[model samples]
Target chain A: MTAALIWIFLPFTAAIGLWAWSRHPAQSTRLATLLCLFLATTAWLIPIGKVLRLGPLTLEIQPILLLAGRRLNLTDTDRPLLIFFFTIAAFWFAGAQQAGSHRLFIPYGLAIVSFLVAAMAVEPLLYSALMIEIAVLLSVPLLFPPGERSVGPGLLRYLIFQTLAMPFILLAGWALDGVQANPTDTNLIALASLFLSLGFAFWLAIFPFYTWVPLLAGETHPYAVGFLYLLLSTTSLLLGVEFINAYGWLRNAPQLYLFLRWMGAIMVITAGIWSAFQHNVGRLFGYALIIETGFSLLAISLNSRLGVEIFTMLFLPRVIGFGLWALSSSILLQAGRSMEFQQLERVAEKWPFASTGLIVACLSLAGLPLLAHFPVRLVLLEQVARQSPLLAVWVLGGNIGFLMSTFRLLAVVTGGYFGPRQPGERPLQITLLSIGALSLVIIGLLPRLFLPMFTGLLSAFTRLP
Target chain B: MTLANLLLLPLLLVTISTLIILISQNWRYSVLALALQYVGVFWLINGLWPLGLAVVKLVAGWMACAVLSASQPAADVREEQTSPTAPAFRLLAAALALALVVSVEPSVEARIPVNRFILMGGLLLISVGWLHLGITTRPIRVIIGLLTVLSGFEILYAAVETSILIAGLQAAVTLGLALVGAYLIAAPTMEETP
Candidate 1:
């Protein structure tokens, strides 16, 4: 049996089965959590391409799976990626119970996992673009659950942007088909770079293409959008890394690095400026995510071992940051409070845990000291300063913008003045909120605690500088 | 019809129908024109695959139109809703798209193995479709624009690379787009706010 069958197909079949068995949101959440946890644990414990003796039987998982004239190669190199994705899935699935997403979230999320892994695994790698597009097609239903009478323009825009990206990336792949033999084909490289940049920009929601992020955040359920953003960005970033891994010219191009850094800075600076002036917390959700994307790009642009290390370090903190934001904001939303400044008056008095979680999450996203995102942001900034002092200032300016937004958000949640206090937070919610916030603070103070888990994944991109 | 004319017929149909869809005041005619455009796309795909496989493209397009038509308000009364822009805007857009397709086709053909008719038709659809997307606030209209663009992409990609996986994916995308479009049309409160 192929390892792809075990890791990819098995989960896919089970996801569908679970969906068929029950559409109850709570039941689906629990089942999905268990399934994702199981998948994640198995990925960590079971090494592929190794024979194991089980009582009288011998079991081994082969590395390749051939389906419909395509190959899915699950090599030892892919082990870390699988573990990373499944672990990420487990984290979100575990949150589903608290967030109360629809029943289809797990099933659709599982199927999305299969499709994304297939995109990575599929040979004749151009097919990955199609695979990714299929994932986009499925996301429509997931994002706009067939509820009654309405769908958001944000989801449509999201779909359109993602769809627009596919043709460009595929076209780039087609253009770069024989680039290895003709490395000096400057025209080909230019065309491919243009196509690739546009594709990644749409995928990453950089600069002008980022308007949909805030719209979707305000429109969709916060928890669903959070999961959607994390999965989409993580997968696209991996694919972006794969692009660099495949092409020596793209990797070595001094101009490309400069472009990435410039674009990253722009994303940061813009997100910062916009986030600061935002009156709605839902809108802040989008800006915080864009800030994370900008930071990730900046980390990649550093083009150093430490840069890659920082990139890896950025992951766990991001998961925590986005999770805290999604869960807290969702809790507040369920309590029938709008995220708008006027509506949010005295909300903190009613739901302290939810309010506190939202603030800490935003603060962490802003890279505040003693928050989860601070350590990685600090390392990345130090690297940037060594490269250029002026750019470092701009980068600092961006974070300060986010910090201002968080301050505004804190004030809004806390109120212009402390109003009438209620019977504080539910114990379960307070406990969860405390754990999430404490982790951020603790991880910031001692970065080593969570930094080790990421080191192994960094080695996967061995080709990166 | 001669083979040469058969080759030209669908392209002509596609161009005429898309132009009408772009400039027309009535939504019903626009939907019908989109279906006609898909038929043109299917003929273009015929050059790349077996007749059986090519039929999927036509089926998907027609099905999409059907779904859109179903969601549309009943057509007993006559009400024509023109675009906010002058008809001159479409003409200008078409001319620009024509310039783009004419300029880009030779290079596109050189890089990718596809039928010239398909390439030109698809390129035209893609170019005009992008214009349509950019100008519209209407969700259903935007979806039609997306279908137009994807029809172009599917024709080009199916020619360059032929496999069951991509074929299935293409069909699924078409079906999904139609579903989303239907959902949008039925949406009680339109979100053209963005």
Candidate 2:
């Protein structure tokens, strides 16, 4: 536990120390890159159940830590979550070095990681609002590059929507507290359950509240967008799990779960349609996130341990896939000096490796068969069918929309034969694409290997009773 | 007053101030109204010290407000110096304020859910300020609106009783945001003849 605490805090401390030393940009970048690598490595090395002992006390570093007044727990279920965050942190750092944005990226990346860890460590019922706020604030620097155009309006909008969602979550938490005080308080529990689900819907950026994601994506660098999306989706899903785990009464609220299912289905379909029409590469990434989040919501609305397991497994591939996509896009934007689809279209053949990676990532994201997303999609579909056949149709439509959008980009990237191709090839680009494509195929073929780990993680929540 | 009342009263005051700013036709009152709101927030933080970790926050809020006020431009130099107050602004503010106050004071017989009420009010005020800033073309007005929203959020965050680490991060992020806002306003892209 102490080691985990130290591991999370070290980068955060380094971020501050590096910021104060920002006059020496090179030194700051070097120090931050080291910290990022250190954090990523430590996250992978830590055993799932290893508890750290300090003198007279022993603290377990699992998902749940029951302190005197607050609970700081990380269950087996959270293993994938921690891995997702740290892995992204690591990749963002590496990509920043390659893209020459390390000075800004490192500090924001560390702060983001610290905020995510803090979000995960705190009990969701009590601290969801604070978690969202921290995530929002951490994103500001990343969204608006230093000395770039002001992201004031965009940042403010993000803050407002997130803050607006907080009251519902806090109120729901308060209601849950009331129910805990008296288990017979069905009325309070029901209201709390409804509010909590709705609050999560907003927080997760479903439909109407999702405007901010695209705006931020359009304005910010791809790496920043990836980081923000990862944090929001993963943490929001975990918060949903925590809510269900903490409130047993919520399990019986079939109507609320049904609402969530339909909501998720609508989000999936709408996001898919939205992605189909987007011209900007950044907006495409934003819509893709919305679609992915829709799948996660579908998994959660299944309201079973199986649903939880699938949701947890979803994060691993996404972290790798999105990281690659963001890196590729960042490279393309830098090389082309614009994020416009027209500029990107011209260089598609020139940057063949990056273009390939982007295409593969889009396919994986769309849940095409024989890719990383297939297994999870199959499970989610089965669960949705079990709930309602109409839901299955909705999920299918969403899947098709996602595929169509990916194909749209793939078409452009393969070349419309309209512009001259640039010269020069980088080995690292090829390596990244190959690794991404290889992992997608490997995971698609052997889904069971990943299933057990996520299942074990989900089982911890059921043990709460 | 009971410990609960101590918490509830200041929150009520903040909510009322939010309503005043929201409903007032005179945009000039917003800064004063927001500052007054923070003063109420200061009182709540002082009263709720026994909740643990709030003492540090109370002191921090005081220092922040002191520095901000000292550096802030005088009202005479504000962008709205010659603008006429609009009835539409007053109506919108009034409606929002009324809704917020009504919601905070639930019909049920209980001390208003202090923590939750304050949080809700803070969110509402900030969102309003955000909208005002986003829609306005004037740079100075936009900056003031953004600052108002941020300060409103800062007040609500003070009540969270976060760890020292989280608090420090929050402060740093806030400062960074301010610097970014200032830079944007100063940039040539933002300049226009008013």
Question: Quick one: best DockQ, which candidate?
Answer: 1
All DockQ scores: 0.35, 0.16
Task: Assess chain B of each prediction and give its TM-score.
Answer: 0.89, 0.57
Q: CAPRI verdict on model 1?
A: acceptable
Chain B in candidate 2 has what TM-score?
0.57
- Per-candidate TM-score against the hidden true structure: 0.94, 0.80
Model 1: lDDT of residue A285: 92
RMSD of each: 3.0, 5.7
Off by over 4 Å in 2: A20-81, A100-102, A123-125, A418-425, A445-456, B1-29, B42-87, B108-194
| Tens digits of per-residue lDDT for model 2, A228-259 | 77877777777777677766677666775777
What lDDT tens digits, residue by residue, belong to model 1 across residues B1-194?
A: 53333667888888888888777766788899999998898888887778788889899889989998888778632334565676789878888998999999999888776667878988888988888888776777778888988888877777666677777767887878887787766645433211
- Which pairs in model 1 have colliding backbones? none
**Interface RMSD of structure candidate 2 (Å):** 8.3
Minimal lDDT window, size 10, model 1 chain A:
A140-149
